[model samples]
Target chain A: MNRTITVRPGLRDIPQGRLGMWLLIAGELVIFGAAVVSYLLMRIRYPEWGEQAQYTSTALGALNTFVLLTSSFFVVKAHKASLAKDSKNVVRFLSLTLLCGLIFLIVKGIEYSTEISHGFTLRSPGLVDSGQGVASLFWMYYYLMTGLHGLHVLAGMIAIFVVMLQVRKGKYFHRVELAGMYWHMVDLIWIFLFPLLYILK
Target chain B: MNIAHHEMSFWRRYIFSTDHKVIGFQYLITGLIMAAIGGYLAYVFRYNLAFPAESIPLFGSLGPKEYNAFITSHGAIMIFWVAMPLLLAALGNLLIPTMIGTDDMAFPTLNMLSYWFFFLSAIVLLLSFFVPSGPFDGGWTLYPPLSADAYINTEPDIWKSFMTGGTLIILALALEFVSMLMGGINFLVTTINKRAKGMTLLKMPIVVWFINFAVIDFMFSVGPIIAGAFMLLLDRVAGTGFFDAYRGGDPVLFQHMFWFFGHPEVYVLLFPSLGVIAEVISTFSRKALFGYKFIIKASLIAIVLSVVVWAHHQFIAGIDPRMATFFSIGTILISIPFAGIMLSYIATLWGGNIQLKVPMMWALGFIAIFLVGGLTGLYLGSDTFDIYVHDTSFVVAHFHYTLFPITFFGFFAAFYYWFPKFTGRMYNTVLAKIHFWFTFIFFQGFAFPIFFLGLDGQHRRINDYSAFDSLMSSWHISFRQFATISAIILILSQFIFLFNLLKSLRSGKKSEENPWKANTLEWQTTSPPPHGNFVKYPQVYRDPYDYGNPDMKEDYLPQNKVI
Candidate 1:
């Protein structure tokens, strides 16, 4: 929550620098959109691949989903508090956001450890036990999408920690709202990712 | 107002230059040095093709493997490192701020970072040449399976190293994207929100509109391909499976992601140069730009079509026939907007008192040459013509014809047009004209013959081909000899531009505030602009091309002058 100085008026009243943050998110969305479309298309072409997807731990995925949904809710609350300039409430909600993210990472780490111990590695029959195409393309997507999302999770924590430094200094209070907005976005992405990866199956 | 007499010391004034003019020239010199390397590689491979067994007089003997290595590195350097940086960035960075009324880029530190990142990307690319088994041999496209496995071929390390270069290229692109993005945001804001008090959108120059659209197009289109490059790199060298065909990875998926950026990447390099020619045409002609509104609309249309028509490159790559038909029609339709732009430029000259300056001469050349290139592309766009000629020399020739001339001829026009203002000295017009004429002639002499050879089915990127007919052999040999001879001339002429840079600065004729007698606001500033441009920023009162206004005493009216 960079709470020091706010960005000055930019090219637009919304502020061009602020617009850049949103536009970069839009650009990130498009990249994720391409990857998502490829994922769905791969599934459509190889229906049996779902068999491989089903073997993964649905419980841990659902747990992470709950964690992210809670994180998003907290970040939204933080935005509201910051906008009101209620400093204490803003800090409270932001801490909740951090807590939820930590829980989600721990849940994911456990899921990966269990999967690895069970021998569902990228090159083994544990991936293709159900059928031929099921093991190959299915596990590949499993690793790619989750791996990418998990990396984003790691990135989100770094961003939150940076905001925490700002919070202590009481700098960029308005930027806290902006950072909260980004935090909510990261949580929101997992909401979509969770249903597709775990709950729907 | 003495730009030459800065109180600041050497480091502050020159190295960390905040002057837009200095930064622009910095981009130019860096890109020019890279062009020499890019062109030399093109000659080496071309010579190997024409005389497979023989030694050349200048550079000596070439081995078969080394020949293909040159071809691979040449394409990579020319497309990524050379053409885009030199033609667009070098020229675009220079002209954007000055042509608009801004003194410098919106964020000057980001501007400095863009050049530094470009320097870093260049180093990464150059380092690939020193890697074991030499630089990439998998073609600039870097297709997978061939590019994927560590031991698929004996030369896997080179493919892998080049992929590393591709990653650096993306980083450089991200930096460029930030700079262009900041430039566009600033240009649009300035043109829309900060234009000298009264310069309305309609009253602003067409170049602003063209570059604005180009910058917006670049911001959105760059992300997906950047993500794709990371994916391709992971699969190629890092033991990942993003494009690995046997590892449940889809090769076709790589094609999809690539052409998405790959298609618009064409216009990303082009629209700025086109903007240059469009402005030059109206500027030198001493007339109001003919159909300025229509030209703006035409450029907007080009940007839209660039994104929608990307799949044209994938016509024969096992695409579903229905999708292929959809993209085929798309490829053909893009020509309509381009044709409209051409017509508007030609009509701008109609009934106008034209100045046949060297800049305008190159603009005229760009129009004719790009027209021929555009028309030839229609042949490749047709599904039937595309099937036989997809990867053949025909495709290669078409792109070279389209992009090569634009990079050299069109961008150089912008360079010559602005040299006086940026450097505060007049380039010798005779030397400028001589460089233009000789380079244009040799440019055609080198690239034009490739189209015929392509039609005869000589595929690109191969080292030796004695298997083709004797007619093909003779044509290839003769073209190579001519291309090599002419390439040396092209390389040498660049030094003339460099010499003009040094000589014109110290002793060339002193230039007036408005040297070209044009109506753009940048001209209203001192010969080379100060740290903060304008003595109380001039309020715009007329169109950028209000050349023959009967109310004005002179043939040209400055954009700032009121009735």
Candidate 2:
């Protein structure tokens, strides 16, 4: 890629698209940071929230973490393939990454259904009725944090699928790295979500 | 400059155009229209407050609910819909590329999308007023308990909740924040990546630097509030307990989250207005900006201090005393940096060929009026003093003094400053000056009396003062009547500005390329620059404010001139 050096010397070495992506990542991180910080503050106030953590299915959380980690590796490989101008390998690794996103979402869907069927929904009826009203807040935060993460996974899958299609047509290879970077952010957020929600108990 | 261009249809060129200037104009007009709506809302509420149940001329009698909704919408619309769109989005889109000597924004399509998103959010907010329930009446801050109590005792249904005013307003705000985030990214990237050959960072205009800081401040501060808004919406719709104290949630947590974004949000508005004042002061004074670098550094320090002073707004909202003390000190400390910046502006005006143009008049009005607002703020910033005067009309007067000048005064200064470039025609200076004086005098007449009334222990957000016999003294009644009359005249005076704008667009004299003979890169281009902006791309040599240089033949030097 040909790069035109602008008068600002410091950022000229960074591609404009990559720089834009990094700034966007910074914004998204702060957003998630708010949720994380709020949760940690509330968790300290109510240690019994760890009791609600027992219901989060640690085994499934671990499996999804592995799946997301593998997807991150696949996206990095796709970035490498795009650097080499190998569109075929780029498509291959991107599709693998998309597949992992799909598996992670499926696992999350199953866990959500199991929790709901077991009367552990966002507005859990049993907790509210038992006069431990604050405990229901734990379930609310649990669903909110994981549910927001699940939406990101779905968005990442769509993004990866689009990039894969464009790569298949031998166009816009640089978007592969942008898509990879976004996927890493998604993966990184889940890494935080996992220990906080599932393993803390 | 030699690039060939093709003609496009009207829809592509104006409505869906990716050009920054056209998009800027779109935001400008939209914001002005929203300002009209907000102003009308203010008139209705002010009329009710003064007359106490007397029917208004244009609108009928105002009820308590209607009065609450009007004040709430007026505050929300002015800040979110008017000030932000006009100052940050409109001015940022217009000036960043032009002043930096670039053809367009780095991401033009995203820039276009940002305006459309803002347009959509404006529509949503307007539609919110006509919902079954009136618009959100829990104040512009959207404090919980009041905001979250929409359907407290009933079973929550998604569709039912969606139609309510509170939920719709939150949705509108979320959309607005998304739009601004997109616009912020575009501003940051464009200013960083696209500049002329010799236009280094320091050589860029102060307005561009201030816009960048405002955008950065916005991006960092708005996140927690976005998260908080989501939680508040869930509390309304999904039977969730994110901010309901009765349902295991703490409302104070919402206050912390809201003010976390709210206080910096003031700077997000102030910084750009200050930037406009800097440009206007330097130009009209025919002097180089005094302490230009110092002003920028001081504003940076002020931005940092702004983030830590959010809790000052919450001293009487049940925060810890120690935390309030820390916040009070922080809030008082913040005034120093701002004072330094203001002093620099005054210093820039010291001993030079000062021209009292319409724009310069507005700029001077801003510094004088905003000082009153800023100094009054220190009293409220202290925890001890705030406990007595919290939620009084004094706070109301303080903010209106600050915000009215920042938004409207700053806007008129910018609008008149760039009118020629915007339309390629000179405005009627006599009518413009008349408009400015009417606005300035009446604004002070309207907002200044409230300080005395608030000192007399008159509370805000009360529709009818008849219920409180103590608040309805002859002295209080006269002040209300005087302020309301002044506000009415203040709202009506805007028509003169509109008339001036219309007259200029139709039959005014053609403006020269550099009417002011100033030294910004934007003036180096034609009045109403062409599609590619410049016949030849400019190469900058010096800083934006090089007025009255000793070695120069002319009093001012343009940035692009190769001296």
Candidate 3:
């Protein structure tokens, strides 16, 4: 009864963090995917949504998308550096990714303000009169999708901030890759959200 | 690996323990407490329906809104707070790590966090009852328009109460979902990465495999509902038009999203209990489980098909006609996998050395009761038949027949079966059997007549049939009294269980390592195995059930025993 046994790992054997993160990714995709399907379903019924799409600032949206894509590159670099045990580069790249998240948030804030300033709001007073019936739905999805994605971005930044501090203490460096993967997920969601919200029309 | 070697403070050892078993009991105790609360709510509502003119003691008076609150809270609490935790969280946590020969979960701290979040969710649910608006009365499904309009244009204080209470229920559900998500990750990772030497996937117990399948299904299924909940929350609090038809938001969209999660949630509850019955029956019958591979395939089929059948719940909600037909056929098709599983259980029991232990009685009871439940499902699954029984007592009876056996009988079977191993004490067998008979008979007596009332077209969620003279037939009133009496008797029988459980814990015969001589890894270790579980890591040599093997001298052969 005192004997200790070792299990043989199969082909898919991997770290818990990577496995858990991938499963989390699958669940997230469904959530975002549900919203996407809803948008497409409603869009088919109401072709007039093209008018509501005009209220969004495509330039700002494109800028934020570029920021997220670049940040994802930094996240990949961070994962590579952490695998090499280069704690400095892990912290540096993670900091850069977090910075990109902040920049995207700033650009998003500008786009939202610009839209709201023109009275293109979630509760705009004259939605029924103007017959933006379908267009209002487009904006509704735009705000909800982007807003949810933004929360994910904020979560990613907080995760990286903690990982950065741990890396600075020269311990728990494995967390850097995990945090980077999460940040990349945020970027991945934005990659889907950008064109659907800003450029689909 | 010696768990007893290390000593810790009381707080660290129990209060904030990270041990899987501790967390398992935490889930169990909390779920039971919530069950009691939910049951009391049922008692109150049943009494109201039974004696409409009379005011019950302790809970003096019941208004229409108050009656709605009781029903809403009862459904939500029982399913989310009680059944989910009891089956998935409690049994799943206690068994998976020990059975798979893992010292702890892949992430034990995350496991602990899951329990605390569940605790927080329970507290939030209880708090909703105390709120000024007295919990959301829009029913457990929380169909929108009612749910959406709950927060609008009431008196300022009352409006605030509704807003707070509604949001709390939604937030509590969200938290529970996340908690289960964390638990699901641990289950998947542990099963995939942490099995003992030679414990191949198929060689594992059916209970472990079913739980693994269940967690994965739950992971994918819960997503859309969480999204829908957020949209509903926005509609309620933020004035977003997600479900507000006045703002061009179709409430039916919410139905699609909700049932997308809701229908699969039934399987999430069903699979684990099915797994439990399989183990109990095989172990008692002294034979290998029949159709082991087929059972696995059947579970997988059920999982895949569950997602497509959700619209069956929304058939009469003004959904597209083509969509209704598609969902109807899809729902009917799901019966095939369930039939396969049920048939496998009966086949397992055929021509075997039978032992009618308390656990086995409950297992056989589950099959008998669930068969009625499953057959009634076919009736409701057919679109034409469903149009007649849609919101009637028939639907309620059918649902209880399906869920009651799985949740109550299933959990009780597991409880009696595993009590010896975890507690290192054998319960009073006579008392256990008595509890079973009372529970089974009364449960049937309670739910069976609801079918007749439903056929009479008595709508559900009504506080009192006596109040509705137009809809009330003599049969409806009489059956209400009968069902209510059966329910009271059914609830009282649970006291026999509680008394037996507590009395046995204090004074009972000590148990051996393998009290029932079952051939599984958890039984191979000492009764109440140490924190690291096994003194030596178990290496499996055969499938879990090798009962009455001709080559073996004993009636059962443990998995770790080399042939």
Candidate 4:
């Protein structure tokens, strides 16, 4: 009885909605690619502006990285549990993943507020090599990249919540696994972003 | 294959429809109406051009500011509102669905939203004309400094209208892009996963694959533009200094963003409708598209090339010389794929049972015009040549060749091909051909000399060119004469199309379910298709182009049936 009902098609079969998500993701990856490319070029042109890097707090970013990585573990467990017809564990592990997502967003909000109070506004001035002042390009990129990532976290949380509701209703159970994969991909992006923004000199 | 899950309603079926066919027609209708407004604006401005600040015989003598207003509004409406919408939104709507076997789009509600937003955009655009500052006069590009200060002394502060309208257009294009993306996924997934069982990727019709590629093209290309729109809107209202140079921003940045979308917007307008023309001629003539596989491979190559070549438009914008040369060469390289597709179409017509139908003739006309249009494109892309022709009548001439001929002519070709499927009745061959020739000859008159004038270094957008050497001045005078005559002829050509559509609804001969014997799944359904589309799901076995094969009894294979 347990073996008869699996939520998703075996590896060969891809649900329509899941494939749509992947296609949509490919488009998204290019957009992020561009903004990231712009950031890389701008950063390379100006090297000594590592002062902004000191304030970005590698410890918090590393902590958030661990939280996101750990959340993926719970999401994978939830997917496997859903396939095994263990709805109880599915609910438990998914809730944990969702909690981690909320924590990540909350921490990001705190970081943004702290940076603003420190007078690191997007258009704030910084000293160049000769004591000439220029608007902070690094900070502009900081707000653009991190701010966009923050929005993605909010979106991911919503997607996870929808998956929970769907699992409750016993509808589109196959979709949860795919959604989890996508959520992990979003988390994976931040993993790179964290090291680049916070960990790097 | 399970269409039971995909049924829709009457309001949802046609009017306010999400059906790509309906949406395509809606886009077509909206584009032509905009064209008429835009086209007339050009005529009014031409009179202003021939006799500066003088009242013309018709529509009253124009004022200087009105010329400024007319020139700005006309260029914006024609290029963005008419050309882009007609070719991409209208034609892409109709063809993407039919070429693939999908019953309807993936998200029907979203599809409807796309057209309505386009409608809102057109309204916003027209509304600006009536406002004080008398609509933006800073040309359609709407460069900063000229558009910067609020009317020191001008009617409706129309720059705000430009801002509001331009944003709506971007939103509409975004909506179009999203719905099309969903439709593309459906096409790709259905082609791969739900291909009526027997249809293989190679077996899919050439047109099916073209639209599939178009979906991917718009998806990747549109994002930068979407971000650009937001920034422009921010600059417009939010006091953001994104493009406001005096406010510590870069004006050229706006050009970078606009052209990023603007340049690929050409392919967005070109490829899908060309796909339709490709399908129409091959099927009607009882032949497979020549080099079908290479055309497919070449188009994908084209999509990749389009993304990188956008900087070609900015060669003169003071970029690094090294980067400029690289982009210029890339822009020229992009033409290679276009050459491949054109050669394939011409070869498809070879050694076939050529149908001399109105649609076939229009398709041939498209080939001729597009060839010239495309080949001359080489000039605009080369850095050395571009320096001479940039912003001149020659560049304008080159585009009008490609755009009007393909977009209008190719769309008409599609109209005659599928008007039966859409309306369940045949169009009058006499009227369609009549409309075709008048517009075709007039199009020649309109575009051909404008090329020569461009060679003469005749600049565009001037209110008067009467003082130049007569040889150079002749280009403007001749331009004035031929352009106005062609404009009126093209505008009148629409009536024949409209009359045929309206009359054919009740009066024309009823068509069989699949009159053209097309291989695609749209033909598997009834003439207009049913509410759920089909009672029995179609299973595919043979390719969409099984025509003239000795192994097959019928000339064409239904995409659903086994060989």
* C-alpha lDDT of all candidate models, in order: 0.71, 0.90, 0.86, 0.70
Candidates in descending TM-score order: 2, 3, 1, 4
- What DockQ does candidate 2 have relative to the true complex? 0.68
Worst 10 residues of 1 chain B by lDDT: B150-159
Best by lDDT: 2
lDDT of 2 at B70: 90
| Model 1 C-alpha lDDT per residue in residues B296-413, reported as the tens digit of each score | 8877877887888788888888888888888889888888988888888898898788889988998998888888788999999898789988888788778888887678777788
Q: After superposition, how far is residue B395 of candidate 1 from its true place, in Å?
A: 2.1
TM-score of chain A of 3: 0.90
Local error of candidate 3 at residue B485 (angstroms): 0.7
Report the number of the highest-DockQ candidate. 2
Residues B321-372, candidate 4, lDDT per residue (tens digit)?
7988998888989888888888888888888888788888888888888889
* Segments in model 4 whose C-alpha atoms lie over 4 Å from true places: A1-13, A85-88, A122-133, B1-37, B40-47, B54-98, B106-183, B242-261, B463-475, B549-563
Query: Residue B237 error for model 4, in Å?
Result: 3.6
Off by over 4 Å in 2: A1-9, B1-6, B150-154
User: TM-score of candidate 2 restricted to chain B?
Assistant: 0.98
Q: Which stretches of candidate 3 lie over 4 Å from their true place?
A: A1-12, A126-134, B1-6, B150-163
Per-residue lDDT of candidate 2, residues B218-299 (tens digit): 9999989988988888888887888867557889998999999999999999888889988999999999888988988998
Candidate number that wins on DockQ, 2 or 4: 2
Better of 3 and 4 by TM-score: 3
Candidate 3 collision pairs: B394-B454
Error of 4 at B389 (Å): 0.6
What's the i-RMS of each model? Answer: 3.6, 1.0, 1.7, 4.2
The estimated TM-scores of all candidates read: 0.89, 0.98, 0.96, 0.86
Query: Considering TM-score, which of the candidate structures 2 and 3 is the better prediction for this target?
Result: 2
